[model samples]
Every structure is written in structure tokens, then in C-alpha cells.
Target chain A: MRSSVALWAASLLVYLFLYVPLAIVVAYSFNDSRLNAEWVGFTWHWYQVLLHDEDMLQAAANSLLIAFIASTCATVLGTMAGLAMHRYKPKLLPFMVITPVAMPEILLGVSLLLFFIQVLNLTLGMLSVILAHITFCIGFVAIVVKARLAGMDESIFEAARDLGATPWKTFKHVTFPLILPAVVAGFLMSFTLSLDDFVITFFTAGVGVSTLPLQIYSMIKIAVTPEVNAVSTVLMLITLTMIVLAARFAPETLKARS
Target chain B: MATPAFADLLKFRLHKNLTRWLVSGPPFLFLLLFFLAPSLIMVLASFRYPGEFGGLAPLRDANPAVLQGLTLETYRFFFSDVIYAEIFFKSFGMALATTLACLVMAYPLALLIARSPRKHRDLMVLLVILPFASNFLVRVYAWMIILGPQSAFAHAIGSALELFGITPVPLLFSPVAVLIGMIYVHLPFMILPLYTNLEKHDPVLLDAAQDLGANAWRRFWDVTFPLSLPGIFAGSALVFIPVLGMFAIPDILGGTRDMLIGNLIKEQFLGVRDWPFGATLSIMLTLMVLAWAGFSMWLARKWSHSHA
Candidate 1:
């Protein structure tokens, strides 16, 4: 009994350590003062201020637009790749798919930036950011969908083919529907990843473009204001909502754990 | 009639192969062009000299008359410089510290969660992932506010310490603060894998060990720890590599004093505008990460085999 209580207490402390900082962010978002030193009375002024900040709004919009387009493309391409891996059992496919994820983000960012500017000669902006995001996001989407495909029953495909259905028709009618939840989950996960990405986006952002993270980074460099906290709270809310929705769509993803 | 059916089957097989190619072709080419090609370019550029200003230019710009145009000056400079070596060592030290700290904290929490009821276990896992879904920078910034000297929490702690005649230790802009941030950011990564591994642990084995007269500690040491080695390997990798490459935490919380390899790489590219040197640093970091990953995989495999 004593040991169980000790274990319970330790776990509680760990959870508190994990959550207190986030609580601070949410709590301070409503602080009426500009300085983060001491809380004055509570107010919604920072959220109002956040709404009016044109550059922050634009950065947020740019992030959303990039995430939407990049994740959509990553999903389509990754789904196909995942399907191929499941059906054909390609030899080099896993290595190619997993490397980007395992590689450090800074290296991936710098390498892509070099390739774009020197080799491809593309200017850095939304397009470059989107393309860079898609490269990494594809790996994640492919992994998620591949896990889903691996768990799926293979006999369904055989059954479809045993009927009058052609290969394409079988995939379209049977395989696609069964895996649609996983595909949607992968898309949401990719979207959230692209949205939250900073290190890679920072390197490839070049001169003009700014995501919410870049904007927050610059703001925090100067000072920690309530406005930054407000923006952070909003970003956190959006991220959590998307993840929860993704989990709802694909229960199997949560089951895999690793 | 037999020949026609055989031909039809052959046609169908051909169609299947074509469809497979069509499905997998785009992503394969996409990774090859953007992911694989960029890494290759980084490797090539690392050997070349920097441009007139700072960054690396195209190889075509090199004059044919210059025999030793491509040089190992950047790499030699990296080796000769004491600061570069120190930064690499310090980065590794911090990463090691963070991994150990995460493990110490994560093991108990994971065991507790694993032992919990089913619904509670799921909820705990969800809680762990929720913070990760939030913006990474924002979460780090939250640390800044909490640890700031002027904040209420900090002030309260300081005053409480003052009552005991102990001076408050400044946390912001210190290595201690950087470690805190690193551990906080990475704790979830450690916990998730450990929880996953621990959740699958069989209670029957523990009961049998107890029935065989083994104490709680012995049961955990003999059975639980061995079973969870894979999680330890995975969680260590997940925590270590990212912490080694992390710049944002040290940049925001540690201020200018705590410089690591990640910051050095960032400075070379963004701050100093030396792309070749930056690429060299990136290549070096990549090699270290790959080596660590390979070593861990081998260790895990060997351990599992021995135990089996």
C-alpha cells in the first residue's frame, strides 16, 4: 500500500511537471498587462490585439494554406505509395520512406534550401515552403497508411478479384473504402505536422515568408507579451482539435502507439 | 481456345504491373528528387569552397585555372577550432543528460499508466500526446514565462527560499534552464514508447514470479526490465537525436551563453552566411545521428536474441 501510494504520487508530480507550463500559457493569455512579470486583472484584450495584428494574421493564413495544399498532395502520393508497399512488398521502399523522418530536421531543411536555390533555382516563398513540407509530410503519411494497410485483411482483395472486378476496380471499390479512415487520419496528421513545423520552415523561409512559428519566434526574441501567449493558445487549440479529430477518424492509429 | 485464355491472363498480369508502377511512381520520384537529391547536393557542396560573399555558389563558377579550388579548409578549420569541438562535446553531453533524465521520469509514469485501468490508460496516453500536438515553440515559450525571474511562480519560490536564508538561483539564461526545457519538450517522446512497451507486459508473469517467492524488486528486475529494453532503446533514440539537434530551446531559454552544434549550424548558414561550412556541420551531425541509430538497432537486436 505504501509503495503504491508512492508510485501514484510520483506519477502525479510527473504529470504536473508536464502540464504546468501549458497552464501558464493559457492563463497568461488573458493577463491584462503587457509584461509577463506580474498578472494585472483579467481581460480579453490580447486576443483582440491578436486579431488586429496584420502580419501575425497573414503568417497564420500562409501556414494554413501551405499545410492544406502540402498535406493534400502528401496524402494522395503517400496513399499510393503505402498501397504499393502493402501489395508489392518493395525492397527499398521502407528505407526511402523512413529516412526523412529519422534525419534531423535542420539537415533536411538546409539540404532542401540548397537544392532549391542552387539546383532548382526556385525563389523562397509559399511554394518553396509547401514543397519542403510535402517532402517530409509524405514520409509520415506513408508510414501511417502503411501501418493501416498492414493490419487490413488481405483476403478482401482476393475476394474482390474472385468476383468479376479487375485490379483497378477492386482497389477502387474495396481497398480504398476500407483504408479511407487511415488515409484521412494520415492527412490530418500531415496537416498538423506541416502546421507546427518550424526548424525546416525557418531555414527554407528565406527572406519574405513567415509562418506563425517564425513570427512567434521573432516576437519572443524581443519580449514575451500577452499577445504572443494569445496567439500560442489559438495555435495550440487548433492543433489539439485536429489531432483529436484524426484520432476519432482512425482509432487504429492510437492503438499502434509507437 | 487455350491460347486465347493464356493470352488474356498474360494481358491481365501486364495490366497489374502497370497499375502498380503508376500507383507507386509519383512518391518514389518525389522522394528521390527532393529528399535524396538534396542530401547528395549537401554532401557535394560541403567539399567546395564558399562564394565571394559567404554562401556556396554553383560548381560551374569555379575557375579552371585554380588547381586547388576545391579544398578541405572548412573541415580543417572545424577540427583546428577548439570552440567547435567544445560545442560538439557540449551538445552530446546535454543530449545524454536529457535522455537519462527523461528515462528516470518516464519509467515510473509508464509503469503506473500501464498498470492503470483500461479507460484511464487510454486517457493518460491521450494527455501525453496532447501537449505534443501544440506548437513546439509556444510550449518552449511557456517555459520562458514560468521560469522568468519576474513571474509569480518564480517570485514565490524565491521568497520561500529567502525565508530559509537561501538565495534564489537564477534559472533563465543558464544551462540548467536549457536542460529543463529540453527535458520538458522530450518527456512525452520518452513516455509514449515506454508506455507502449509496458502496456503489453503480462501480469501473469509477475504473479508467477511472486508465487515462486521472488520479491517485487526481483520480479521487476528479472522480468519487467528485460521486457522493456526495446522501449528503452526506442525512447532513448527518440529523445537523444532531436535533443542533440535542438537549437530553439537553448536559443530562447539559455540565451547567448548556451551554444550547441545546432546553433553553430544555424549560425553558419543564417548568421554567418557560410553555406559550405554549414553543409559540413550538417553532414557531420547526420553521420553522428546515423551511427547512433545503427548502434542502438544492433544493441536491441543482440539483447533480444540473447534473452530469447
Candidate 2:
């Protein structure tokens, strides 16, 4: 009894350690004073400023646009890579895709930056940011989708093929339905990753292209603010909602396994 | 309904081969071009110099496609630069420290989660994964407020410590601040895999060990620790790899004084417009990550094979 109690206390304390900072930030978001220590009164003025701040507003818009486009592209590419790896006769595809997963983001970011700025001579902007995001996001999508594919029973595909179904028909009628959940999950994950990314976006995005993260980073450099907290609380809420929804709809088996 | 579908697949093997290629070819080509090709081009460009406005200029006197011929100047310069060398070492040291700290913090948490009552397991799991659900930047910035001197938590702690005759160590803008940021951001990555593996462990085995006259420490060492090795390796890999190139946490918490490898590469590529040196550093960093991953995988293989 004592040991179990000790374990419960330790776990709860560690979790609180993990979340208390986040709670502190959310609490101070409503503080009337710019200083983070004392709360004179509760107010929504910081969030109101976040809404009204023109640069922030534009950066948010850009972030949404880039995340949508990049996630969509990465989903398609990643699904394709997953499909290819599943179906390919070649012995080399797995090693190729895993390379991106193992490479440090900074290394990938710098290498891509070098390719764009020097060889391609493409100016950095929103376009470059989306491209950079898709480059790595595709790897994540492939890995997740590949895991899903590996678990799916191959006999279903074979059964469909035996029933006089064309390759495309078998895919549509059997394989696609089974993989659709993974595809959707991969899409959502890629979107979240693109939205949250900082270093890659920072390196690839130049003048006139500021994502929410870059904007937050610049503000952080200037000085820490309750405004950042207010914005973060909003972000955290949205993320929590999406994740809960995904978990609700994710396949029963995967949910259990995860 | 009872047809041997496996037999049909075997009979149509040749056609299946062609069909599979047809379906998977597009993504293969896409990765080949955008991912593999760009990396190769970067490698090639590392040997060339920027011409017009520091962009790659067409070679007028050489083969039409060869923009600029190979040169070793970039590698030479990177090796000779004191700042680059210092940043590289500092990044490695910080990453190692952060990994160790994460292990220290996470091991206890993982043990707690693994031993928790069945009713609370899901909630416990959810808490571990929660930090990863949000934006990376916001997560780091959250730490900024928590550690800042005038921040409520910091101020409260500071005042309480003063009353007890202790100096509240200045937490913000120090290496300790960066370490805190890292531990906060990465603690989940360490715990989840450990929990996954630990949750699957057979409690009877440990009980059996105890029933056979093993002590608590002996049971833990002989059974529990060995079983958790896979989780430890997975978690360590997850934490160590990214921390090597971590940019935001150090930048925000450590200030300009605590530049890591990531910041150095960024400065070279963007701030200074020195592409070749950046590429050299990136290559070196990539090699180091690969080396660590290879070593970890080898260790995992050895552990499993011994058990087998």
C-alpha cells in the first residue's frame, strides 16, 4: 500500500512539474499587468491585442496557408511513398526513406537552404517554407502510413484481386478503405508539425514570410510577454481539441496499441 | 468465399509485380527528385563558389553544365574557424547533458507510470504525450515565462528561498535555463517509449524472482532493467538526435551567448551567406548523428540476441 502510494505521488508530482509551467502561462494570459508576477485584474486585452496586431494577424494567416498547402502535399507524397515501399520489388526503398527520419532537422534545413539559395537561386519566402516543410513532412507521413500498411492483412487485397477486381478497383474497394484512417491521421499530423515547426521554417523563410513560430520567436527575443502566453493558450486549446478528435476517430486497434 | 486467395496471388505473381510498381512509382520518383536530388546538389555545391551576388554563377570557361569546379577551400575554412569549432563542441556537450538529465527525470516517471493502477493508465499515458501535441515554439516560450525573474512562480520561489537563507539561483539566460527548456520539451519523448515497453512486461516474472529468494534490487536489476533496455534506447534516440541540432530552446533561454551547432549553421547559411562552410558543418553533423544511431542499434541488437 505504501509503495503504490509512493508511486502515485511521484507520477503526479512529475506530471505537475511538466504542466505547471504551461498552467502558469495560461493563468498569466489574463493578467492585467504586463509584468507576469502579479495579477491586478483579469482581462482579455492581451488576446484582443493578438487579434488586432496587424503583423501577427498576417503571420497567422501565412502560417495557416502554408500549413494547409504543405500538409496536403506531404500527405499525398507520404502516402505514395508508403504505398511504394509496401509494393516495391526494390530492396533499397526503406533505407532511402529512413535517411530523412535519421537526419537532424538542422542538417536537412541547412542542406536544403544551400540548395535553394545557391544552386536554384530561389528567393526565400512562403513558397520556400512550404517546400521545406513538405520535404520532411513526407518522411513522417511515410513512416506512419507504412506502419499502418504493415499491420493490414494482405489477404484482403489478394481476395479483392481474386474477385475479378482491377488493381485500381481492388485498391479503391479494399486497400484504400483500410488505409484511409492512416492517411487522414498522417495528414493531421503533418499539418500540426508544419504549424509547429520553427528551425526549418526559420532557415527557409526569408523577408516577407513570417509564420506564427517565427513571429513568436522574434517576440520572445525582444522580451517574454503574457501575450505569448495568451497566444500559446489559444494554440494549446486548438491542438488539444484536434488531438482528442483524432483519438476519438482513430482505429480501435491502433488506439489500443498506442 | 472460401477461395485460397494466397494461391491466386502466387499464380499472378508476375502481373502483381508490374502492378505494384505502377502504383508505387510516383512517390519513389518524387522522393528521388526533391529529397535525394536536392541533397546531392547541395553536396555538389559545397565544392563550388557563389558567383553573382553570392549565388551560383555559370562557369564561362568550363563544360556548360558544370557551374563551378570542385574546391577544398570550404572544408579548410570550417576547420580553421574557432567559433565554428567551439559551437560544435558546445552543441554536443549540451545535447549530452540534456540527454542525461532527461534520463534522470524520465526514469522515475516511467517507473511510476508503469506501476500505476490499471484505471489510471490511460490518463497517465495521455499526460506524457500532451507536450508533443502543441507547437514547439510555444512550448519553449512557455518555459521563458516560468523561469523569468519577475514571473509569478519564479518570484514566489525566490522570496520563499530568501526567507530560508538561500540565494535563489538566477535561472533565466543561463545554461541551466537552456537545460531546463530541453528537459521540459523532451521529457515526454523519453517516458512514452519506456512506458510502452514497461507496460508490456509480465509482473509474474518479477514476483517469481522474489518468490525464488531474490531481493528487490536483485529482481529489478536482473529482470526489470534488462527488459526496459529497448524502451531506454528508443527514448534516448528520440531525445538525443533532435537535441543535437536544437535551435529554439537555447536561443530563447540561453541568449546569444549560448550558441549551439544549429545556431552556427543558421548564421552561416542566412546571416553570413556562407553556404559552403554551412554545408561542411551540416555534413559533419549528419555523420555524428548517423554514428550515434548506428551504435545504439548495435547495442539493441546485442541485447536482443543475447536474450534469444
Candidate 3:
């Protein structure tokens, strides 16, 4: 009985440690003062300020645009790659896919920046950011979709083939529907990752472009104000919502606890 | 009639080999170009000489007189630079500390969550993931508020310490502050993997060990600890690699006083505008991470094999 109590107490403290900081951010967002030192009565003025800020809005819009385009492309390509690996079991495919993810983000960012400026001579802007995001996002999407495909019944594809369906017909009729949830989940996961990405975007976004994270970073570098807190709260809510939705559409690993 | 012929033609073209290529080829080519090619470029660029203005020298500007513009000068500079060497060591030390701290804090919580009822288990898992959904910068910023001097918590601590005639230690912009930020951000990464591994553990083994008169401590050491080695390895890797390269946390909370390798790399690129040196540092960091990962995996395998 004593041991159980001790365990419960320790776990609760850990959870609080994890959550208290976030709660503080939400709290400070409403603090009437610019200085986040002491709360001087509650007000929604910061939220109002955030709503009116044009640069913040533009950064948010740019982030959404990048996330949407990059995730869609990653999902399509990743799902196709996942299906191919499932069927063929190529030994090198997993290694190739995992390399981008396993590489440190700073390295990936710097290397891409170098490649764009020196080799490709492409300008650092939204297009380069999207391309860099897709490069890493594909690995995550492929991993998720591959896991989904592995768990699925292989005989269903055989059944479709035996019924005189062509290879494409079999995939179109049988495989696509079964893996659609995983694909959606992968897409949402990619979307959230791209939205939250900082290191790579920071490196690749050379000039005249700023995502929400990049903007927040610059803002924080200058000062930690209530306006920044308000923007952060909004960003946190969007990412959390996307993640929860992604988990809903994801396969067994996410749902397994229940 | 035309549609039927087109359908037949499509069927004719879609052979097994062709289908396989069509599915995998695009993603493979995409990764090769964007992922593999960039890394190769960085590696090649690291060998070249820097220009007078910070970035690499133009091809034509490379004096053909000196071994076709390739020199070990940047690498030589990196090794000879004491500040760079110190920053690399400090970053490695901090990463090791963070990994160790995460392992200690995460183990019990993971076991508790794994042992919880089904409905509560899912909620606990959600709690672990909730913090991760927040922007990384915002989360670090939140830490700044809590640790800053004006916060109530800091004031209370100051008052309590004043009663003992001891000075209130400022927490922000110090190594301690950076450590706290690192552990807070990475705790989830450690917990999830550990929970997954612990959740899969068999309760029967514990019961059987108890029935055989083994104490709880012995049972844990002889049974549970051995089984969770894989989780320990995975969680460590997940926390350590990112923490090693983490610049934002130390930059914001540590007040940019201490420079880690991540900050150094950033300084080289954005601060100093020296692309070649930045590429060199990046390559070095990547190699270190790869080596650490390989070593951890090997250790996990060896331990698991020995125990099995």
C-alpha cells in the first residue's frame, strides 16, 4: 500500500512537471501587462493584439500553405513507396527511407541549404522550404504506411488477382481502401511535422519568408511578451488538434493502449 | 470501342516489374535528389576553401595552383580552434546528462502507466503526448517564464532562502536552466517508448517470481529490467540525438552565454556567414550521432542476447 502511494505521487508530480509550463503559457497569454512578470488582472487584449498583427497572420498563412502542399505530396509518394516495399520487400528500401529521418535535423538543414545555394542555385523561399520538408516528411509517412500494410491481410490482394482483376485494378479495388486511413494519418502527421519544423526551415528559408515557428523564434529572440504568448497558445491548439485527429486515423500502435 | 482499346493497352503496359517501378521509383528518386544529394554536396563542399566574404569561394576564384582549390584548411582550423573543441565537448556532456536524467525520471512513470487500467492507460498516454503537440519554441518560452526572477515560484524560493541568510540563486541563463529545458522537452520521447516496452511485459513472470519466493527488487532486476533494455536504448537515442543538436533551448533559456555545437554550427552559417566551416561542423556532428546510435544498438543487442 505504501509503495503504491509512492508510485502514484511520483507519477503525478512528473505529469505536473510536464503540463505546468503549458498551463503557464495559456495563463500568461491573458496577462494584461506586456511584462510577463506578475499577473495584473486578466484581459484578452493579447489575443486581440495577435488577431490584428499582420506579420503573425502572414507567417501563419505561409506555414499552412507549406504544410498543405508538402504533406499532400509526401502522402502520395510515401503511400506508393510503402505499397511497393510491402509487395517487393526490397532490402535497400528501408535503409534509404530511414536515412533522412535518422540524420540530425541541423545536418539536414545545413546540407540542404548548401545544396540549394551552391549546387541547384535555387532561391531560398517557400518552394525550397516545402521541398526540404517533403524530404524528411516522406520518411515518416512511409514508416507509418508500411506498418499499416504489414498488418493487413495479404490474401485479399491475392483474392482480387484470382478474380481476373489486373494489378492496377486489384490495387484500386482492394488495397487503396484498406490503407486509406493510414494514408490520411500519415498525411496529418506530415502536416503537423512540417508546421512545427524550425531547424530546417530556419536554414532553408533564406530571406523574405517566415513560418510561424521562424517568426516565434525571432520574436522570442527580441523579447518575451504577452503577444508572443497569445500567438503560441493559438499555434499549440492547432498542432494539438491536428495530432489528435491524426491519432484517430492512425493504425494499431496509437490505438493499442485502449 | 476506343475506351476498351485504351483499357487493354493500359493492362498490357502494367506488368509486375513495371508496377513495382512505378510505385517506388518516384519516392526513391525524390529522396535521392533532395536527401542524398544534399548530404553529398555538403561533404564535397566541406573540402573546398572559403571565400573572403564567408561562404565558399567561387569555382573560378579557386587558384588552380594549389591542388585544384581543395584544401584541409577548414578542417585544420576546426581542430586547432579551442572554442570549437570546447563547445563540441560541452554539447556531448549535456546530451549525456539529459539522456541519463530522462532515463531516471521516465522509468517509474512508464511502469505505472503500463500497469494502469485500460481506460486510464490511454489517458496517460495522451498526457505524455500533449506537451509534444505544442510548438517547441513556445514550450521553451514557457520555461523562461517559470524560471525568470519575477515569477512567484522564484520569489517564494527567494523568501524561503532569505530566512536562512542564503542568497537566492538565479536559475535562468545558466547550464541548469538549459538542462531543465532539455529534460522537459524530451521527457515524452523517453516515456512513450518505455511505456510501449513495459506494456508488453508479461505479468505472469512477476507473479511466478513472487511465488518462487523472490523479492520485488530481485524480480525487477532479474526479470523486468532485462526485458526493457530495448526501450532504454530507443528512448535514449530519441532524446540524445536531438538534445545534442538542440540550439533553441540553450539559446533562449541559457541567454546565449554558453555555446553548444548546434549554436556553433548556426553561428558559422548565419552569424559568421562561413558556409564551409558550418558544413564541416555539420558533418562532424552527423558522424558523432551515427556512431552513438550504432554503439547504443550494438550494446542493446549484446545485452539482450546475453540475458536471453
Candidates, DockQ: 0.71, 0.56, 0.61
On the 0 to 100 scale, the lDDT of residue B286 in model 2 is: 77
List, residue by residue over A125-226, the lDDT tens digit for candidate 2: 988898888887887777777778888888888888789898889878888888888788777777777888888888789785998888888888887667
Estimate, for each residue in B219-304, the C-alpha lDDT of model 2 and write its tens digit: 87999899999998988888888899887778788867998887777776777776766667777777778888998899999999
lDDT tens per residue, model 1, A137-255: 88777877888888878888889989979887998899889889999998998899999999999989898799999999999998667999999999999998998999999976564
Q: Kindly report which residue stretches of model 3 are placed more than 4 angstroms away from their true locations once superposed.
A: A1-3, A251-258, B1-14, B60-68, B160-166
Better of 2 and 3 by TM-score: 3
| Predicted structure 3: lDDT | 0.86
Best by DockQ: 1
Tens digits of per-residue lDDT for model 3, A1-258:
023776788888899999999999999898888887887889999999888989999999999999999999999988887887888888777777877777668888888888888888898999999999999888788888888988988889889988999888988889888898889888998898999999899999998699999999989888777998999999899988888888888844253211
Better of 2 and 3 by lDDT: 3
Each candidate's iRMS in angstroms?
1.6, 2.3, 2.2
Candidate numbers sorted by lDDT from highest down: 1, 3, 2
Question: What residue runs in model 1 are displaced by over 4 Å at the alpha carbon?
Answer: A1-3, A255-258, B61-69, B156-169
lDDT of 3 by residue, B1-308 (tens): 89999998787676777988988899989988998888888888888877677778865645665333667878999989787888888999999999999998899899899989867888888888888889888889998888899888878878998999998888788898999999998998889999999999989999899899999889889998889989999899989998989888889989666779899888888888888888889888988898899999899989878877
| Candidate 2 Cα errors over 4 Å, as ranges | A1-3, A251-258, B1-18, B49-68, B81-83, B156-169
Which docking class does model 3 fall in?
A: medium
Provide the TM-score of chain A alone for each candidate, in the order shown. Answer: 0.96, 0.92, 0.95
TM-scores, each model vs. reference: 0.96, 0.90, 0.94
lDDT of the structure predicted as candidate 2: 0.78
Which window of 10 residues has the lowest lDDT sum in candidate 2 chain B?
Answer: B52-61
